[model samples]
Structures are given as structure tokens and as C-alpha cells.
Target: MIVLFIVLGGLLWLISLLLFAFSAWASYKLMRLLWGKIRRALLRPGTAQITSYEVFTPDPEDIHVQDTRPQIRLELDCERHGQRFQVSLGPLTCEELFPALDLPAHHIACWLSDEDWRQLLEKRWVTIACDWRLRKAILTSQIRNDRRLLLISFLSLSLFALTVTLSLLPH
Candidate 1:
């Protein structure tokens, strides 16, 4: 009976480890993808006049405070020959918390060029370039943050599984 319990515990541990490893691998790939996106945004630096901005909030998980920022997608009328495009800016993270704890919607803190900000507030249609540095910073921040959250969740789950398994063993 003791040997059976031990074998089961080992199996559980192995399963948890496998899950952690897979998630870590996924996170690494995602980080690389995000880095590539940042490089592309920097390289392109497309010009467009703002039509409007659409806010897209992902299913707000109470994952962590840092993961709470909503994504803002820009609707633009491109400059060269008046082509229209919806350019992705940043899924920006912010320092401030949402006003209500129950509310999933809140503002995010992110960097933007002064001119772009003013134009954003005034709702003026002005030609704008992709703010390469700010976009890169936002992407980097999100990559690091999501990885951190994944690790934390994995650790917590592993700990819980260990505790439950050990307690069930006939000591």
C-alpha cells in the first residue's frame, strides 16, 4: 500500500513538472514572437492619420495587477494614397488600479509621444508615426510580466499538489 502511494505521488509530480515545462516553453516562444513584433514595428514606422481608436479588453482575469491593462487598437486612414488600416499599437500596462475592485474595466499607464497624446485628446486627424521606443518598451514590459505570472501560478499549483498528496499518504 505504501509503495502504491509513493508511486502515485511520483506520477503526480512528474505530471506537474511536465506541465510546468510545457508552459515555460510556450512562454519563451511567446517572448520571442513579441520581440519580433517590436522589431517589425520599429522597422516599418508607418504613417497614418487617426480615424479613431477602439479599446479591446481581453477577458479580464484577476491574474495580477500588472496584467490588467486593456489593448487599444487604432483605426487609421493611411497617408500614402489614402488607404485605410487598423494598426495595432500596444496592449499597454499601467501603474494605477481600477476605481472599483469588482469592475474589470480600467485605464492603463503607457508612454506616448507628446504630439501623439495631444492629437489623441483633441480628436484631431494628424499624421502620426509609430512611436517605436514606446511601443518596444510596452511590449517588453508585457512579455516579462506574463512570464512572471505564469511561473507564479505554476509554483503555487505545484505546492498545492504536493501538500495534498503528502497528506493523503498513510503516515
Candidate 2:
């Protein structure tokens, strides 16, 4: 009778350990899922259109290549409100801006080769949150939604970490 009781208790402990491990793994997976969704949402970004764009090509003859680096000046027009602003950015290749964004081969190729910057800017609407300086002007209702999602994701991650830490502690 004593031997049977000990065996049953050991089995229960092993099962609980397995359950705990599984829950931790599941939480991690959930966190990753949330992040993927958030990234995808950011890929399209906010409601803004580029009315005009200027690409400043550096002169090879210029000695100060650092200062005369390839820059793009964009005239952003917010669709939500009739707000207009100018944003200056460096060359934004598909590989640079959306490195993790899984775009089609043709789209990536077009973005890389397009001299006029049409493929990236003129073709579609972009997020007004192009530069940090313009954050105050651009951050509207969309920012709130993004913040809520981020908060939830962080909380989930923190909970997962705490669970793992507590589980690792000596019983």
C-alpha cells in the first residue's frame, strides 16, 4: 500500500511539471503571434499620402559625401485631416525599411530599381509616422490602438517570464 501511494504521488508530480512546461510554451507562442499581427499592421501603417517627393542625389564631385548623402524629401498629406507636412528621410529601400516584411519578389525588385521613388512612395499611401519629429502631429487614434496592443503583448511576455522563473525555483 505504501509503495503504491509513493508511485501515484511521483506520477502526479511529473504530470504537473509537463503541464507547466506546456503552458509556458503556449504563452510564448501567443506572444509571438501577437507581435506578428502588430508587425503586419505596421507594414501598411497610417492614412497618409505623399503629394510630392524630391530625391537629392549626391554629386560624386562633392568632397563631403557624408553631408550630401542621398536624401528624400517628402510632402505628406494626411488623409484623416487636411494636415500637410514635409518629411526628410534617407534612401528607404524595401530591404532597409521593411526588412522583415515578406514582400513579393517583383515588388522588392521594383522598389530597389525605381529611380523616381514611385514604387515606394508615389504608388501608395504611407504612415504619417515617418519620422520621430512628426510624431506629435501624426499620432492620432491609430497610435492609441497600437499602444493598447503593445501593452497587452508586453504584459503577456512578462507573465510568461515570471511563470518560467517561478517554475525554475527549487521546490
Candidate 3:
């Protein structure tokens, strides 16, 4: 009976230790995942400093040079200081450029000079993409929360089993 009690106690201790270890591992994994998400959010395209520019459909009068097509054009315009420049955007595609432009639904398509156009595009793309990614991260966090809860429950159950086995052993 003494031997049985010792054995049972030892088993319980081992099981509890294992449960604690697993719980710690799960927590570490969760922390790493959160860190990765934060890093990605900070570093992904458009999240960092503005790097490029674009021009959507511009008014013919506003455009210094006119082209037959009305497409949106993206240009690298970081160096042009205050000078109004014009670039011909061949054609405007609402689906492809609207989200990138971050224009309001009620806003009308108007002409913007090359400089103003670049600034607007840089601001629009950064703002929209950041918002979209934040929403996506929130959804992913919700799912991960559920998984973490399940892992905790499993760990608790293992601990419970250890306690029960110890109690049932003969004195």
C-alpha cells in the first residue's frame, strides 16, 4: 500500500509538471504570433513612409498634356517641388483604381496635377491598405483566441487527471 501511494504520487507530480510545461509552451507560441503580427503591420507596403505616387483621371483643362485615353497612371513623384506637371492617364477603371484612390462614393472624378495627384494617391493607398490589414488582423486574433482557450482547457484536464489518479491510490 505504501509503495502504491508513492507510485501514484510520483505519477501525479509528473503529469502536473507536463501540464505546466505545455501551458507555458502554448503561451510562448501565442506571444510569438502576436509579435509577428505587430512586425508585419509595421513593415508591410504602404504602412511605412510614402514611397510612390499615382495619378487617376484628370480634367482635360487641368492636364497640361492631354491623351485620348483616361486611364489612371502611377508615377514616382518624390522630387518635384511645387511645380505642376501633367501625365496622361490613358483610361480610368473604377474597380481597379477606386479602392487604391480611397475616394468617397459621392466624390466625382476630377483632374489633379501630377504633383497633387501623386500626394493624393500616396495618402489614399497607405490609409486604405492599413485599414484593410487592421481589420484582417482583428479577425485572425479572434480565431486564435478560440484556439488558445481550447489549449488551456486541455491542460486543465491533464492536471485534473493527475490529481484524480493520486487520490485513488491506496494509502
Candidate 4:
């Protein structure tokens, strides 16, 4: 009886260790995601006029870079707090998270629609959400679906965690 009790306890301890490792990984990923958002929020928001942009599509004929997506290169003139600067950003790539199965279209952030891409090209202006401290600039357009996708990711992760927790309980 004592031996059986010890074996059960060891199994439970092993399971707990696995759970701890998984939880730590999840927390690390969450923290990294949240930290990026916080950093972006803290930065001063500014819009940079897209002075010029060039779209580069990798040669489909070349096997070397055929699988690569299109890249957008931009020259931006940004002004913030009476200080104006010109910066170049690219080759920017966008991919949507949940892409439609039927379409062959390339997406930025895995969600940017064909129409949005067209407008971005035609409008010749983009919102510059940049981190000056990092010397990096991110050009973005508003998309409602982006937020929905983020929510979905969180919910899915939470659901997975719940499932694991439930399975660990005595049945």
C-alpha cells in the first residue's frame, strides 16, 4: 500500500512538473506579446507621409526566392513635435493570420484584404507607428479583424490551458 502510494505521488509530481514547464512557456510568450504592445503604446504616435514606395515581387521563375512574398519598400517623411525627418522602411511584408483557403492573394499581417492593399497603394500615405528608440518603423493601416484574431489567439490558448488542467484532475 505504501509503495503504491509512493508511485502515485511520483506520477502526480511528474505531471505537475510538466504542467509547470508548460505554464512557464505560455507565460513567457504572453509576456513577450504584451511587452511589445506596451512598448508600442508608450512610444509617441506619429503619421508619416509615404513619399514613395516600391513593391518588389520575387521572381517566380527563380526557385531560390520563389516562395518569398512581395515586399513593400517605402520612403517616409515623418514629423513629430515640430521635428521632421525622412526615413526609409522596407521591404515590409504583411501576412494575415487566418487566410481564406480559395484565394491566392498575399496578405500582410495575415489579414489585410485585397481592397485594403489597393487603397494603401493608391493613397500613397501610411500611418507610422514607429519605435524611435529601436530605430524601427512599422507602417500599418487599421483593420478590425486584426483585433479579432488576437482575441481568438488568447481564447484558444486559454482553452488549451483549461483542457490540460481538467485532464490533470482525478477522473
Candidate 5:
């Protein structure tokens, strides 16, 4: 009877460990998949159109013509062209665009200009080859990390199970 209890407890513990390890692996895989999609979007040749644009201000009134200074202007350039267009962007939207453009959020504002904005608007096909190339690199790194995590988890779980099973056998 004591042996039976010991074996059952050990099995339950092993199962729980396996479950946790798998969950972590799944999380890593999901992150990698998302990173892949982002990389593709960024790296594909041609300008991605400016699908949308926004300007965000904590106080709407701050954006009013009467206001002397605005905190920052956010632009959403979906197209890869160097055209000019007016688009509004909020802080959150800026964050979302960073991964898509493969550029740091801080650098985005610097790239904005009247001529560039006009070009972006005029260029129907915005080539984002540079962005895409950078994205590809990032995705590759993510995939490598995910693979490493999976390998580690599988090995740990196997070793643990083996140890438990051997311990339970007659010596």
C-alpha cells in the first residue's frame, strides 16, 4: 500500500511538471509566430500604404489652433512611399507602428517631414524592403530562442521522469 501511494504521488508530480514545461514551450512558440508575421510585414519589398493616421493629445483642447505648443505629432505611414499627408497618431498607435516599421519609436518623429509626408501619400506602393530585412533578422532570433526553450524544457522533463521511474523500481 505504501509503495502504491509513493508511485501515485510521483506520477502526479511528474505529470504536473510536464504540463508546466509544455505550457512554457507553447508560450514561446506563440511569441515566435507573432514575431514572424511582424518580420514579414516589415521586410516585404515596396512601400506599405498608409492605411490610417491619427494625432493624439492628452487634452483634446491642446490640439486646438489656439494652443501654442503641442507635445508631439504622431503620423501613421502605412505606405512605403515618400509622400506627404496629414495623419494623426496617439501614443499607443505610435507604439504599434514601431514594430511594423522596424524603427524605434523615438526615431519615427525625426523621419517625418513635409516632403517625405507628401511623397508617402503620393507613392502608391511604399517599398519597405529595409524594414522587412530588419524584421526578418528579428524573427530569426525569436525562432532560435523558442527552439532553445523547447529543447531545454523537453530535456528537463525527460530527466525528471526517468529519475522518478528508476527510483520506484526494485533495487
Candidate 6:
């Protein structure tokens, strides 16, 4: 019975180490894609038209805090070319747009920027040159606030140490 516990713990510890390694590799790749690949790309377009926009919020599991990231979808008008496209940027917070937010939230509608919305509304066409793949953004966010990940790392190390100590004990 004791041997089974030790073996299971050892396996989990090894798995956590592999997971940590993968996370590091993924983070490195995401940063490279976000900055290195698009260093010269323009973040904003000279002209953009906001035909429509909608804000979305998922059901909150707890009253204390929201669960899902807030998102907004914008349908842009391409008047000069005669085609329409949609662009979205979300899971935003006050820190992303204005001076700062008192608390950081994964979801903030439009970064609470009326001026930004006005800018989009004023223009008849819009373009985004430097937007990254959604996958990259998700990975970046995971790395930014990885509480569960850190916990797993610590647990893994402790398990490893415990397994070593157990093996050293008398049979």
C-alpha cells in the first residue's frame, strides 16, 4: 500500500516537470510571435468603420467575481473596397486603454473607452495590421496569471522530495 502511494506521487511529479517545460516552451514561442514577428506591424488602421458591436458576458458562477473573459465583436465596413470584416479585441481591462484600473479584470467591455468607440464609429473603414493569432493571446494570458500552474510546480517538487525520502527509509 505504501509503495503504491509513493509510485503514484513519483509519476505525478515527473508529469508536472514535463508540463512546466512545455509551458516555458509555449511562452517563449508566443512572445516571439507577438513581438519579434510583428515588430513593424501597425497596431491600428488609418480608417475603420464600426457598423455594429455587441458585448458579451458569460454566466458568473460566483457573485464574488466573474468567471469568463468579456468579449466584443465589431463588424467593420469596407466602403472603398465593398466588403465587410469583423474584428474583436477583448478580455480587456482599464489598464489596456486608459490611465489605469484599480483592479485587473479579464473582462472589461471596450476597455471602457468611449473615445475609442467614437473613433471607430466616425470612420467609414478600418484596418488592423498588427493583430496576433488568438492562440498566442491565450497562451500569453495563461503565462501572465498562472496561479494553478505555480501550485502544480510546487506540488510536483514536494512530491519528488517526499518520494526520495521514502526510498531512503528502512524497508
**Clashes (N, CA, C under 3 Å) per candidate:** 1, 0, 9, 10, 32, 5
Q: Which ten-residue region of model 4 has the weakest summed lDDT?
A: 96-105
Model 2 Cα displacement at 60 (Å)? 9.0
- lDDT tens string, model 2, 45-107? 454566766666567787776534345555565433454555543354333323212333233
Query: On residues 132-153, what C-alpha lDDT tens digit does candidate 6 reach at each position?
Result: 3331121123332354555576
| TM-score of candidate 3 against the unseen true structure | 0.31
Better candidate number, 1 or 3, judged by lDDT: 1
TM-score of each: 0.30, 0.33, 0.31, 0.47, 0.29, 0.30
Per-residue lDDT tens digits for candidate 4, residues 20-96, read 99999999999898767656555554566767667667788887774467666777777766866777777655442
RMSD of 6: 12.8
Ranking by TM-score: 4, 2, 3, 1, 6, 5
RMSD of candidates 1 onward, in order: 14.0, 14.6, 16.6, 9.7, 11.8, 12.8
The model with the greater lDDT, 4 or 6, is 4
Please say which candidate is ahead in TM-score: 4 or 5: 4
Stretches of candidate 3 exceeding 4 Å from the true structure: 44-100, 104-171
After TM-score superposition, what is the CA distance of residue 2 in candidate 3 from its true location, in Å? 1.0
For model 1, the run of ten residues with the poorest summed lDDT: 94-103
- Candidate that beats the other on TM-score, 3 or 4, i.e. the better one: 4
Model 2, TM vs. native: 0.33
Best by TM-score: 4
Computed on alpha carbons, the lDDT of every model, listed in order, comes to: 0.49, 0.55, 0.48, 0.62, 0.49, 0.48
Q: What C-alpha lDDT does candidate 2 achieve relative to the native structure? A: 0.55
Which 10 consecutive positions of candidate 6 have the poorest summed lDDT?
130-139
Return the top candidate by lDDT: 4
